[model samples]
Target: MSQGYAIELYFDPALENQVLKAWNVLARRQISTQLIEIEARPHITLLSSPSLEPLKLEGVVRAFAARQEPVPLSFFAVGSFPVDNNVLFLAPKANMALLQLHSQLCDAMRKEGVDVGEEFRPESWTPYCTVAQDVPKTRMAEGFCVLRDLKLPVTGYGVDIGLVEFPPVREVFSYVLGNPVEG
Candidate 1:
């Protein structure tokens, strides 16, 4: 019964729909991954912490959201970690704006005493939208085919910061990014 929150970037509705379609196709092909809950939405995780109170976590996200605006992110490639061939993902190209936001949020969370772990820190994080997880090694080639043909241009803005509970991974609340200059 472990619980935690993740700060994630969500895609536009149209792009989201397409990504869902791909996930369905892969599942139908018998290459489903873990964490395939139907309620889970497509997102890129920016930060996660296993030890923060929900109400306080909400405040942290609110303060972090105030300093950001919708950020344009390009999904330019597909990549997988060799250490864990079980997962496949869409990689977002490097953008200074996105990186800075991640850094700022991580810093803010740390300042507030959230023990954001090492992997999620800006320096060690790899920005990606996971398409599948827990893939069987025997199905690796089949998964690769799905990824190869899954290529499509995806460009959109991450317009809101959402706090998602893990395990079941449900959205608790969302804060639309607003201009910091107005704050």
Candidate 2:
């Protein structure tokens, strides 16, 4: 375990269940079960850094969350990062609202003297919700085939934000951005 934290945007319950179905399917097939093993929630990470101190970060997040409203999300495609370790993800359409929320959260974290990761910077971010990670190159093709048949264009609202720690994944705190209307 390491002292790391991330700011995560989570969708409403129904959307979360839909995503969970994919996670469960992948886990059962023995493709990649790292996420479920670690017990991570379905979320888009806004910013993450091991240097972040939770005490200071929580206030900024609570205040920021209070000021924001539900973020509309559309997961239009399955995506992945090009690295040997690999990551399979759900790609949310980077609409104006989602971009602004990401920007504001980054700025807030910075103002609180938190060191934000450069890759999470607004201009650099590629808003995605991870599905499976640490998948072997040999099996990635199978992972894709599994997910491709699942679905795309999942629409929902990002209703909550949280501060989380990893290596078994613990949620320090979470707040509802606003009242999200369930579809």
Candidate 3:
């Protein structure tokens, strides 16, 4: 089986923490069943590639970092893919700069022999944060209702991109590219 790697765009420090807090509250209230579990960090995927040659990985990160520009993104509604058994958060508003960055990164990855799935096509893309997974239909509805009732804040800011890897059958491994910036 092929290993998975995701190049993702994330919110800045403050916003990331806030989103986490909100998600934790929602999870505690609505997610008590065994059929669903919310895992994975909050992020908007730029590309999901099966594999990258070791040498090419650094180049990919550098290419993405060089083009980095901060942009604001907002989360407004909660939604779900009932058939797929997943719950997603919706960002009712998006920044063009952020979308452009995703596009450019896709183009760059294609040039590097990465086969990004068609699902990521620009026109079909819907920017969202994944809040829960393996959600049954009943829980999905309940979760959506919970999010709908809450006045979720719209968090926004510029954030650095990250590369996450899953080696073989093990769980995901993540690396934050570039030097750490002082707060």
Top-scoring candidate (lDDT):
2
TM-score of 2: 0.94
Q: Against the true structure, whose TM-score is highest? A: 2
* Model 1 agreement with the true structure over 21-96: per-residue lDDT tens digits: 7688778887974545647788889987776577877776877788788888888777788876578888888799
Better of 1 and 3 by TM-score: 1
Tell me the whole-model lDDT of each prediction, alpha carbons only: 0.79, 0.88, 0.63
List candidate 2 segments past 4 Å from native: 179-183
Candidate 2 residue-wise lDDT, 1-183, digit = tens: 666888899999988988899999999999999999888999999998887788877777887888899999999898889887789988989999999999999888788877677799888988999999999888898998888887677889999999898766999899899633233
Error of 2 at 178 (Å): 2.3
Q: What are the TM-scores, per candidate, against the unseen true structure?
A: 0.88, 0.94, 0.78
Clashes of each: 0, 0, 0
- Find the 10 residues in a row with the least total lDDT in model 1: 32-41
User: Candidate 3: which pairs clash?
Assistant: none
Task: Sort by TM-score, best first.
Answer: 2, 1, 3
Tens-place lDDT per residue, model 3, 104-152, is 7778777887776887767667677766556565666677776676566
Which residues of candidate 3, in runs, are more than 4 Å off? 1-3, 30-39, 167-183
- Candidate 2, residue 25: the lDDT equals 92
Candidate 3 CA-lDDT value: 0.63
Q: Point out the worst 10-residue segment of candidate 3 by lDDT.
A: 168-177
Instruction: List clashing residue pairs in candidate 1.
Output: none
